[model samples]
Target: MEFSPIRILGIDPGLRTTGFGVIEAQGQSRVYVASGCIRSGEGSLPERLHVLLKGVREVCDHYRPQQAAIEQVFVNVNPQSTLLLGQARGAAISALVLAGLPVAEYTALQVKQAVVGNGHAAKEQVSHMVQRLLSLNGEPQADAADALACALAHASHATGGLATVGMKSRRGRWVSL
Candidate 1:
């Protein structure tokens, strides 16, 4: 049986700021419902991770999304920063899993290409396209908007079969959610 449209939450994870957006897919259309960021104050990595986890849990509870899409960490020149960011991402994912939600991961390039039609598009260009495609009323913050764009992109591409398929994993496989 064909399932009803699914709600999806997207996350752009960082140690200091983790952005999040929620979207719903219905037939051929996807709508951006909400977007925001989790701001972690200066603290130890573990403390920041705790904040990230709590923030993600709050988002999940508020949105009640069927699945989540998170941007994979890109290779940064700073190894230490990259590792910390990865930890933050892990915390976010853990929260989703604990909340009984599935998760899908996408690279930065994939997110940019899915939202802007170009993997190498500038941040402003991507943000602009996201606003236009999602039909947002006002400009969203760069990080939050990008997170929402990632969620929308996942919904569109997964529904369109441009990304991964099959949704059996507990972590949530990349499917049209």
Candidate 2:
């Protein structure tokens, strides 16, 4: 069997610092292309959202990814904070859609399980696993690592990597088989 390479962009949206990672998934291989953070420095809510929107658009233009994956926002104890994060996520998704890329969303638990074999994996564990999976020389920053994990999760789901590893998707979620 053969498969064409797919360039994927992943985003971890935040009000202050949004992280982005690019990867190429070909068959069973996942190659790291780039990763970085877009710091939406001190600013008003709208201003910060604008920065995130613009930054994500630029990343899409520069990387020319065919697909995108983003972390789904979880409800925080603070309603206001959750709302703000949702807005940031919306900005990122808007950029991806405007760029004509198919976007996928994954929960933090799903990403952790796909990348580190543990749904409850710690941030450090996720970072280490991402470094190993992508053959990165050093551990990426926390945000970038998370974005990479999201991309990896999508790649697994898209390329049947999960099934090869004794996992299966059921009802829009991955279940270990």
Candidate 3:
């Protein structure tokens, strides 16, 4: 039996708002499926993480994605905020892993470059490119758009190059380019 790579769930993790998007990868073509955000309003860090985990799990179960693509955590000027973001990311990862799903993480630069041909592209630029590439009519929120971009980047690389898709380090960890 042959399996089709049609469903993908992309996640942009944050302490406050975690964005999610589902996409379909058919052969060389990728299409938008759905996009939304998991908002964790003013709350404690642990509470926010709980919301992220639950929200991500619900999205995964609902979409039944073949694979999951998540954005890697980046540095922030505020150390506290950065730590909180990392926790949110960890929670998201845990949700996927617990659900027995394969995960690929992409850096902000890699996502921007894959979507807009520029590693340093602005959020709006990347969002616009995602909307254009996927032929989305209206504007998608920055986080949702970024999640879609992450899925497209994975699909593009998954079809073409191994390094682009993801590579396993000697330590047996998957790392995106």
Which candidate number maximizes TM-score?
2
Over 95-133, each residue of candidate 1 has an lDDT whose tens digit, in order, gives 999999878888777787777777788999888887888
- Scored by CA lDDT, what does every candidate get? 0.83, 0.91, 0.83
Error of 2 at 36 (Å): 0.2
State model 2's lDDT: 0.91
Residue 111 Cα positional deviation in candidate 3, in Å, after optimal superposition: 0.6
Candidate 3 wrong stretches, greater than 4 Å: 1-3, 161-177
Tens-digit lDDT string for candidate 2 (3-108) = 8999999899999899999999998899999999988898798898899999999999999999999999988999999999999999999989999999988888
Evaluate model 1: give its lDDT: 0.83
TM-score of 3: 0.87
lDDT of 3 by residue, 63-128 (tens): 889898999888899998889889999999999998788999888777776778777889989888
Q: Rank the candidates by TM-score, best first.
A: 2, 1, 3
Q: Candidate 1 or 2, higher lDDT?
A: 2
Measured against the true structure, the TM-scores of the candidates, in listed sequence, are 0.88, 0.93, 0.87
